[model samples]
Target chain A: MIELLLILCIVAAIIAIESKNLLSSIISLGGVGFSLAIIMLFLSAPDVAFVQILVEVVMLIILIRATINRDVTEVKCKREFFGMIFGMALVTVLLGILLMGIQTLPEFGTALVNASAESVPAKYYIENGLAQTGSANIVTGVLLDYRAYDTLGEATVLFTAIIGAIAILRKKKTNE
Target chain B: MNILPLFVTIPLAGAFVVSLFDFIKDEKKKNISTNIFASLAGLVLLVISIKVIGSAGVYSMGKWKLPEGIVLVLDPFSGPILLITNLISFICILFSFDYMSGYNGREKYYSLFFLMVAGMNGLVLTGDIFNLYVFLEIASVASYALVGFGTMREEIEATFKYMVLSSVATAFMLLGVAFIYGFTFNLNMVSVAKALGSMEAPVGVYVALGLFIIGFSIKSALIPFHAWLPDAHPSAPAPISAMLSSVVIKTVGMYSLIRICYVVFGMNTGQVPEVLRVLGILSMMLGVLLALGQWDFKRLLAYHSVSQMGYIALGFGLGTPLGVIGGIYHLLNHSVFKSLLFLNSGAVYYRTGTRDLKEMGGLGKKMPVTGATSMIASMSIAGIPPFNGFWSKLIIIMACIKSSHPWLAFWAVLGSILTLASFLKVQRYGFLGKVKDSLRNVKEAPFMMQVSMITLALLCLAMGGLMLPGLYDLIFVPAAGIILDQAQYLKLVLGN
Candidate 1:
């Protein structure tokens, strides 16, 4: 069941990327998110499903709002056939690799995080995270306690993006 | 407090403090304080980097154990890079003092500059692959903003193009990092190196390595992935052009690529060096060929950046002790001279308000300082005797011959000769002829700009000394040693 949903997600994502028109691409992207949420729920991860649904809905609405009263038609360019063929070839190669990787994984529902899986990092985190960090949630302990520096870097990246938007979008002249 | 974190923290705090001054109503006051803070931050980082040379340590973040947490390692490899990034960035700040007077929002400029510095500092220092990606984004995004900071139509267009390509590269890098994690289940470079050494790696790991190479090649503006650099470098303000062309590409692009290939994946006995050599020679020839036709001063230099990076790559491709040393020595030399050349161009632009080669002639007589410094720069770039560019190029060429790839040596020498021809064009037509009517009244660049140029020019002369036996052992040997031996790096980071 999860494999079917994941395939659906990949197909929708491909459509989202390959679509020329903005509106179709946006809808295809929504298809990806919705199927992903379904897969999450099926995998017994309702918390992730809930968050994904909420975020996907909000994102789709925002994209639709931005698309209103604008031309969804893409500007056609010359030599697009070769470009499309090239892009398709790349996608096919990447997807082939993805499928190969998937074939080698453990059983679909096996919990690597909690399983006694030969001393993987995730298993170590699951076992010792609560004891060392004093957090009941392993995710919180890993994110905030162990790899908080990465969170700092992530926050800085966000801050830089905001600065970029401001720098790019600012008015030419300031009010005296 | 170990000094590793301060390399990043100083710049981050400085950027924030500079941005806070944006609220100041008086432009002059705001500019003064921001510039002062940015310069001081650069100075402090430079001093600390200098102090840490030849020292190695691992600073674990949040006091967590090695495998579970983030670590910033300062070894012989990263210490010099930290020095160059800070040193060149410090000079750029000085150059911007006068050059940016015409532009508005000095506060925004300095803030973004420091942020870019902070990002690069973290990128160079971090041992975790995922953290490297995060910091790479910070540096890249800040650079995109800086590229378009002028908000001119051309600048904005170039920024958009550069941003698109670089975003793609960063995505490739992140995907590559994900693959590394999946295969080895390790984030730390030392640990990942250990894991990959023990395990029989799958096909996916090689693909991930391919992805990593492509990502960094794009960042460094190698031959095939080099379209955005010519546009982006010229479109940026001069100080920024200097930074992007000089240290930014080296740190985020080639440095990451080398670190991953050597420490994590192991470079010996692979087809990787063969591939890099081909790319290097291709970039060398094509970059110079494309540069030979350019009329725009900055664009021509931008193209040569592609060519110079090729030499460094080719040196690495040789995979010998002399080859790697030549690669690294050229890396330092290229950083100084390229930044100087850009500063010279920026100084020219400041005085004359033009970037076209045809618009200016014989201004050398009028603007003696800019003329002289640029002439020094041109000579250094063209590989004249006693100048820094000549030595590195000679070393690289010799390494090629020593490696028995005399054809590669032939190509290196040919590339250097073509480089000379193009720079001679710059000198003859752009600087040394009759001063054009429009440029008649042009004077030397502002004092601050001259200081920056002269400092770099002096570096171009003195760097030849670095090749001497005394400094060679202290600096070049260990850097090459680290790049060659993964075990030494592992022991440095994760001691037995």
Candidate 2:
């Protein structure tokens, strides 16, 4: 089931990238996001899945709004066949290298018992997180208590993005 | 007191306050409040950085132990970077006091500026890889917005290009981090290093390293991955340009690259050094060659930034004690002079409303302060004796020769000489000749702007003195020592 969902995600991503119309591409992107959210659920990360779905919906709406009154068709430029071939070849090489590298990695769900896994930070967090942070949910404890600074930094990123959008899109008043 | 968290908190709180100032309605009140908040945040950070110098500690969040919690490590590596980030940011904020007035959304500008500062400070100080990525995004996103702050066509285009390229880079970096996590089951630097150090070499490690190199090379605007820099740097307002060129690339790009390569991956052995040296030389030559043809004032300086960063990369690539020192010192020196140069360009644009070098001449007579400071900056960047740039460039070249790479040294020398020639062109065309009729009435930059420029110019002059034994030991030595002896860093953070 997860494999099928993953394949669906990939297909949606390719469609999103290849679609000529901006709206359909965006909708395909939504399709990709939804499949990703479902895969997250299969992985037992329901919190991530929930957030992913919410963000995907918000993003789809935003993209739709942006496309309104704009040219829906992506302008097709002169295709550089050589460049395309070169890019594809490079991608193939990189993918091959990455796959070779991944072959040596521990299989999924088995990493916790791997030789060096005793020292992994997540193990410590899982065991002591609730006690350390007074939160029953270990994830919250990790995010809010043990790694609160990361949360702070993440908040700042969101704030910065908002400020940036406002800085870019705010209507200018002419009078001094 | 644990002042580590405050570094990220104050500017964030200040950003929040400045955003609320949007409701104040009175522009003057809004402006004053924003200024006060920015200055206060800057002042506090400046003082804290000064207070924390020469000290190193780990502040684990929520009172959790190091292995269990996110830690902010204040080591020698972070000390100089934090100091430079705060000092330059404070100066840039001062310059922006007057320089940013013409732009709309003053509050939004300050808010994003402080957030960028917060992001950089966090990036410098964070000891966790994932945490670093989050902060890196914060800084990158804020800069993307700030780069397009003008809302002009070129600015928007540049911002879009920058955003796309940077997002790709970020994606690559995240993939690399994922690989690292899969390999070591750790996100903390010390833990990852420990795990990787104890294990046999894995193919995954090399792959992760490659991704990190490509990702950070883009961030640092190194030769191959530097497409976004020249466009993005010049499109932003002057102070933002200064910040982006001077510190942003260094902190997120070079510093992280160095830390990951040396401390995390252990740089003493491998093809990494050779790759770094080759990339460095390529960037050095290409950046200067590209810079020589540019006539736009800020654009020229942007290209020079890439060229100078090459020198830093070359120094680090050597992987000797002296090489590390040279690289770190060059990083510091470049931030000072490059920022001063950008501010000088900004002042010129402020007065004459033109960045075209050909349109301005004899501005030396009218704007003596701007011209003089710019001359100082130009000389500094050109590596003339007695300025900061000369010392660092000399050390890097000397390190090159000492490392038995005379060809690299030769390339370094040629790059510097070419840099001098182009800057002489800048001096001759932009400041020395006949003033265009339209620019005849141009005045010197305003007081706040002049003060910031002068202070930075003086800093350029004074930075050479940092090579003195006492100051060198105080500042650059420990910083370089951290990278040179990766074990020391691991021990310092993990207390093994």
Candidate 3:
């Protein structure tokens, strides 16, 4: 089942990248996101799946808005043959290196330990997260209490994006 | 008392307040209120940073232990960077008081500026790798908007390019973080270091390191990944340009790269330093070569930023004690003088409504302050003796020769000479020649702008004093020491 979902994701991603029509590409991208979220759900990460779905929806809307009334169908595929070859070679080398590195990882779902031979932080968080943060949802507890600084930074990113959009899109006032 | 959280919180709260000022119908009230709040916030940060110097501790959130909660670490390494970040930010905000008035949306501008500042401060102080990424994105996103704030064709185009490239870099960084977490089961820097230190690095770890290096190299605007900087830096408003060129790249790029390479991966004597050295040389030679041909005043400075960053990278990549000191010192000096140069260019833009050096000349008589400050900055950056740049460059070159890499030292000297030539062009064509008719009536920058520029210029002069043993021990020595001894960081953050 995971293999099927993974293949679906790959197909959708390829379709999204290769589709000439902007709208179709966006829909294909949405397909990829939906499949990925399902995969997350299967992995027993409902919170991640939920966030992924919501983000996918928002992204689709944004892509739609950006593409609306635009002649993006003209999609110029200017292939620089040398550049393409170089890119392919680089990707191949990177993947080769990455594959070699992956061999050293511990087998999947194994109990991981720190250098001190103690259980990793995840074990501690799982056992004590609720008591420490007073939140029922461990994810929320972790995000808001245990790691609220990261949340603050995330909020700042969102705020910056909004302000940046407004700063860029606002019509200039001439009274000054 | 845990004052660490305030470093992230105060600027964030200031950003929120500045955003609220958008409701004010009166422009004067809005402007004055936002400026005061932002500057006050900056002043508070500066004070806190100064107080935190020479102190190293970890502040875990919600009273949770380090292994269970996100922590903010204030080691000797983070100390100097934090100080530089806040000090430059405060001065930039003060400078922008008069400089930013020409642009629209002053309220949103200050809001985004503070947001960027918060992100950078958090990035500098955070002990978790994932937390660093979050803050990195915050700062990068804000800068993207700031770059395109003008809404002009070039500004929008540059912002779009910067956004795409930077987002790709961030994505790579996230993947690298995931790789580390998958293997080590740890997200905190100290924990990750502790984990990796115990065992031989596997393939996954190497891949993760590669991703991090590429991501950070892109962020730092090192050669081959630096195409976005020339376009993005020159298109933004002057203060934003100064901040981006001076603090943003260093904090997000070089600082993080150094932290990961030295602390987490522990590449003290290996292939990593050699890669860094090669990249550094490439950036230094290529950056200046590219810079020598630029005609736009700000664009020229932007290219020079890449070149100067090369020097910093080379200094650190030498993997020697003196090299690290030189790198850290050069980072500080570059922030002072490079921002001064950009601000000088902005002053020229403000007065004559042009950034084309070929179009203006003989402005020395009209704007003595800008001219004098620009000259100081130019000399400092060109590695003239008695200036801050000279001392740092000398140390770096000496470190290079000592490390048995005389070729790198020679490249360093050549880069400096080319830098001098480029600035001489700036001085000759932009400030010293016959004044064009349109620029004849141009006046000096406003009082606040002059104050900031002169303050930074004095900083450039005074920073030379940092080379003295007394101040060196106080500032760069600790930072360099931290880089040299990663075990100290691990012990400090996660006590044995």
Give the poorly placed runs of model 2, Cα more than 4 Å off: A73-79, A114-118, A173-176
Give the worst 10-residue stretch by lDDT in candidate 2 chain B. B61-70
Q: On residues B1-496, what C-alpha lDDT tens digit does candidate 1 reach at each position?
A: 2878999888888887777787898979888887888888888988998888877888999887678788998878788888899999999999999888877788778888988999999999999888899899999999999999988789999999999999999998988888777766778787788878898877777878888999999999998999999999999999999999999999998889888887779864468888789899999999999999999999999999999999999998898889988888888889999999999899888888888998889978988888898899889988998999999999999999998999999999999999999999999988898878888788888888888899999999999998889888998898888888888888888767
Better of 1 and 3 by TM-score: 3
- Each model's lDDT: 0.87, 0.89, 0.89
Grade the docking of candidate 2.
Answer: medium
Reference A-B contact fraction recovered by candidate 1: 0.42
Q: After superposition, how far is residue A41 of candidate 1 from its true place, in Å?
A: 4.8
Give candidate 1's whole-model lDDT. Answer: 0.87
lDDT of 2 by residue, B219-314 (tens): 999998999999999999999999999999999999999988888888655689888998999999999999999999999999999999999999
Best by DockQ: 2
- Runs off by more than 4 Å, candidate 3: A71-83, A111-118, A173-176
Model 3 residue A115 CA deviation in Å: 11
Model 3: per-residue Cα lDDT over B1-496, one tens digit each: 2899899899889888888888888878888888898899899999999899878888887776776678888988888889989999998999889877777688899989988998999889988899999999989999999999888789899999999999989999998998898888888888788788887778789899999999999999999899899999999999999999999999999999999888778886677878888889999999999999999999999999999999999999999989999999899999999999999998888888889988889988789999999999999999998999999999999999999999999999999999999999999998897777888689999999999999999999999998888888877777777788887887788776
Report the Cα lDDT for residue B192, model 2.
85
